[model samples]
Structures are given as structure tokens and as C-alpha cells.
Target: MEIVVAADASEKGLGAAIMHRFPNGRDKAITHASRAHTSAEKKYSQIEKEALSLIFAVKKFHRMIHGRKFTLLTDHQPLSIFGCKKGVPVHSANRLQRWAIILFTYDLPMQYRSSTNFGCADALSRLIANRQPPTEDAVIASVDAEVRRLFIDALRSLPLTAEKI
Candidate 1:
């Protein structure tokens, strides 16, 4: 079986497309989308968008994919090879580490494709719709109470003075 996934994000919204190609040349396609979050509205990085799109595709098709090896295709070069390591690296960004952890379950070898050739996923990605907000709380979830306290302390020390500089 062959699989192709493409994702696109815009200030207006975010979207992803997943495809399963049968050996006979027929194709089954899946499309996923979500509106931008209030928080993510300000922090929607392309790398993050690519990762999220791929994750949605995998989870949506988990029943067909689980415990079996299959092709993984993407337009983003880095995500196709992301977390190639056996485990999430200590130095990885909070979000990336989390995405990697989820992706680790599949035996996927990433392949690169150009943006133009992404097919339906490209068009699907451009569509806007009403959906749940994107949750990207990996950084907050990973922080321990002690770390939070230290961060608070560091912020407090920076400036108690609230005057307009």
C-alpha cells in the first residue's frame, strides 16, 4: 500500500490531506482540517503545521495503519525524516518531541514531494472550516511544578516595576 500526506496552513485556517493508493491504481483520500487557535494564531510555524497535519492523517487512519508498515509521504522534507532516532531527543523542542513521540509508533520512512504535486491534499488544505482549536500545550505539559515556579520567580525578578518604560 502507498500513502501520501500533504498539509497546508494559512492565517485563515489549517488543513491536511491523506491518501492511500491501492496497487491497482485506485486511490482513497481523506481530508482533515481545523481552524486556527487563539494561541496558535500567533505561533503557527510551518514546521508545526506540517507536523500537526501528518499527525492528523495518521490518527485518522490508525485502524488501517496500526502494527503494519506502509509508505509515508510528505511535502515537508524535515518531517518526513523527523525523529529518525529511536527515541525523542532531550534537546528537541517541546512540540517536536511530542509529535515525534506519536509518530514513533509507525515504521514510516519519509519521502519528499514538491508542493505542486501534493494533489487533493493541497486543495483540501486551502479550504476553511469550523473545527476545534489546535491544542499545542506540549511545552506547558512538560514543565514541572518546580520549573514553573522557577520561571515565575525569574519573571518576577526581571521587573516588578510596571511603569510605562
Candidate 2:
């Protein structure tokens, strides 16, 4: 299974999605996540906002993706420099340098994708967060349910299952 994480950030929020890309080249959304930024985060520069979004996505999906390699897609082109292939920047903000150190631990190769082709994450980032956000357990349960449903759907579509029937 090929895993791709797409992340985006807006002034209001950050959004990300973990996508499973089949060998046949179809992409499936394994899970999606978004959250409103804190007042301080909202004041971050554009690059900082983008970096934060990537960090959020990586940490959110860490369990499924930790030790393994994956591709990271971001609309912000400058982020490509932060991939494992490129060494950490020497002259960045303290906050960014710290984030880069954290990201380096993950085996992800960053790729630049244009905004028009990145609607999923873009829309997510623009969404208004609720006054009362769902509990972490509820969010996990929802993602688990979606993954289960997708697994069952894939199984049903297999020719072996059809033959058994």
C-alpha cells in the first residue's frame, strides 16, 4: 500500500489527509483531519503556517505511518526543501528549525503540488471549526469506522470473493 499525506494551511485552520494509492493508480482517502489554529499560530508567517500544517498531518497519522516511508504533498513549494532528502535549513526561525528536526525523524519525501490539484486539503483548511470540537475518542472512532468500511468494500470487490459466492 502506498501512503500519501497531503497538508494545507489557511489563516483560520490546518487540514490534512492520508491517502492510500493503489498500484492501479487510484487514490483513496484513508483518513482526514483538521483543526483551528491557536491565536498565536494564526499570527505565523505563511511558510510557518505551511510547515505547521505538515507537522500536524504527520503527527496525526503517526501510528499508521511512523517507521515506514511515504510521500508528502503540499501546495507550498518552499516546503520541498524540508524533506528528508534535503538537510535541515541552517538559518530558519527557531520554531521552524525545531519543526524540521521533528519532521526529519519521519521518512517522507516532500513533493510540490499546485493548489488547483489539491482541493481536498484546501477545502479542509478553509472549513470553520465548531465551537465545541468532537472528543479525540469520537474522532478516532470515526476514522476507524471509515477504514473498516473501506476494507470491507475492497474485500467485496475481489474476484475471489465473487467466485466463492
Candidate 3:
């Protein structure tokens, strides 16, 4: 099976995509969104968080396709950092650096995809980041459920062909 992974990072949050090739050879995209550090001074933290989120998405994909060949694509520049020995600029915390090191164990190939090609994941990350917080548990649960449903529905409709990068 062939899979394509995409990720996008903003000051406020991060988003990732796992595009899987089905038995019928059709691509299906699954996505996840998470909040992250937003301050300009702490921009490195934001990038680290985005990288971890991308790693999380890869783990999710691995669960679905164990031992399968896959490619990971990200809009972030300096994709070489994924294979670098020295610390990367965006990795502030040792934990984040360790996470990057651990992800390499999967031996998945990393590809540098342009930002224009990752619009869907970028949009989803923004949408999640913009969500209003509710004071009540019930409201939070409702909102979370709705967001998950919407994400799944959007993934189902994503185009198989790679967007022009």
C-alpha cells in the first residue's frame, strides 16, 4: 500500500493528513488537528508541536497499514531535519527532539511537498484553532463530536490525485 502524509503549521495550531491507498487503489485522506504554542518568540515550540502532530498522524497510519511502504509529505521546509543528527531549530524541548528521533525508526520516506498542495489540512487546522471554548462538559463533548464527524466526512471526499504543488 502507498500512503501520502501532509502537514501544515500555523502560529496557533497544527494539522496533519494521512492519505491511504485502499485495496482498490483509491486514496483516502484522514486528518487530525491540534492546538500549539503561538507566540512569535516561542515559534520554535510551535514548529516542534507541529512535527509531533505529524508523527502522531504517521503512527495512526501505521496502525492501519502495518509494515507497508508509505511516503510522508510536509509543507514545512528543511525536511532534511527529519534525518539530521544535530538538533533542529524548531526542536526546543528535548522531548520533541526525542520524538523526532523515534519517528525515524519507522523508516518512512519524507518528501517535501509545497504549501499549496496541503490546503485541506491547512484549512482544517485553522478551523480547529478557531473553535470557541465552552464552559460546560456537554457542550464541549457535542462540539468535539461534531468536529470529528465533519473531519471524517471531509476526508472521505478528498481527491485522490495530489494537488498541484
Candidate 4:
């Protein structure tokens, strides 16, 4: 038996799948995950987009794949570098380098599977709707606004004193 993870990115979104492959070549999909990219993410280069999909999938399926051996499948051939024995490549973008560090924790080997052979993940990526889930930045911005409001309210209630004590 073997664990197989496949990830793909499209102009619309990112998609990934986790599956179990039996010795006889039979495979069963455990789960399929996908999310629309943020505005900032959509501006990423093609390589970065693909790398982001891999990282997103790895994190989404962390519980099932962590601490276990697995095979990472991607249509992006350049991502195979993540599994190279020499380690992270120096020429990779800063974002990819950071993602590589995160990927290093998982004991998985990367493999390049052509898109035609990677239909499940490929379809999912393109099928994603335009809707986007609430982001951490949104939550943090709300919190910051609330704090600033409270600070202003508190200041308004206090009287200013220039007199020396």
C-alpha cells in the first residue's frame, strides 16, 4: 500500500487530493480539497502558483500524511526539486524556499505526473468557484479596528492634565 498526494493550480484556484494505492495498482481517493486563490495569490507567477498549490495541499492533509511516507504528484515538473537529495535549491524564490522548508518536514518524494494523468486534481482546480473563504488578514484587521476604537473611547473618557505632580 502507498499514500499518494496530487496537487494542481489553475487560474481559478488550487486543488489537491489524497489517495490510497494498493499493491495491485488500484487506487481510492480519500479526500479532495480545493480553495479559490486570494487576489494577491492570483498575481503569483506560474511556478509560485504551482508551488503554492503543493504547500496548500500538504497542509490541508497534514493529519493523514504527517510522519508517514507518501508520494507527491504534480504536473509542474520543476517542483520535483523539493524531493531532491541535495536539499532546497538556492535559485528558488523566497516564497518557494519558505514553502520548501515546510515541505522538508514531511517524508515524501515528489514526482512529475503529466496533467492528462492527473485529471482528478486538475479538474478540481479549474472547477473551483470564485468565492473565497475569509482570510486571516480579514480577522486581524477586524481585531485591530476594535482595539483602536476602544483605545479612542478610553482616551475620550480621561481628562488631560498638564500640571506637574
Q: What TM-score do all the candidates reach, one by one?
A: 0.61, 0.77, 0.58, 0.79
Tens digit per residue, CA lDDT, model 3, 1-165: 577666666665666677776889565876554554345423466556567656656665567545666666677765557744554556356766677776666656777767776676677566664544555898889999999999989976877535632
Sort by TM-score, top down from the best: 4, 2, 1, 3
lDDT of each: 0.65, 0.90, 0.64, 0.90
Candidate 3, superposed: residue stretches over 4 Å from native: 21-46, 83-93, 129-165
User: Which candidate should be chosen as best, given TM-score against the real structure?
Assistant: 4
Deviation in Å, model 2, residue 145 alpha carbon: 30
Off by over 4 Å in 2: 130-165
lDDT of 4 by residue, 83-108 (tens): 77667778778998999899888999
- Evaluation by TM-score, superior candidate among 2 and 4: 4
Which is the winner by TM-score between candidate 3 and candidate 4? 4
Error of 2 at 14 (Å): 0.4
- Give me candidate 4's TM-score against the actual structure: 0.79
Model 1 misplacement above 4 A: 3-10, 24-42, 86-90, 130-165
| Model 3 error, position 29 (Å) | 2.0
lDDT for position 94 in model 1: 92
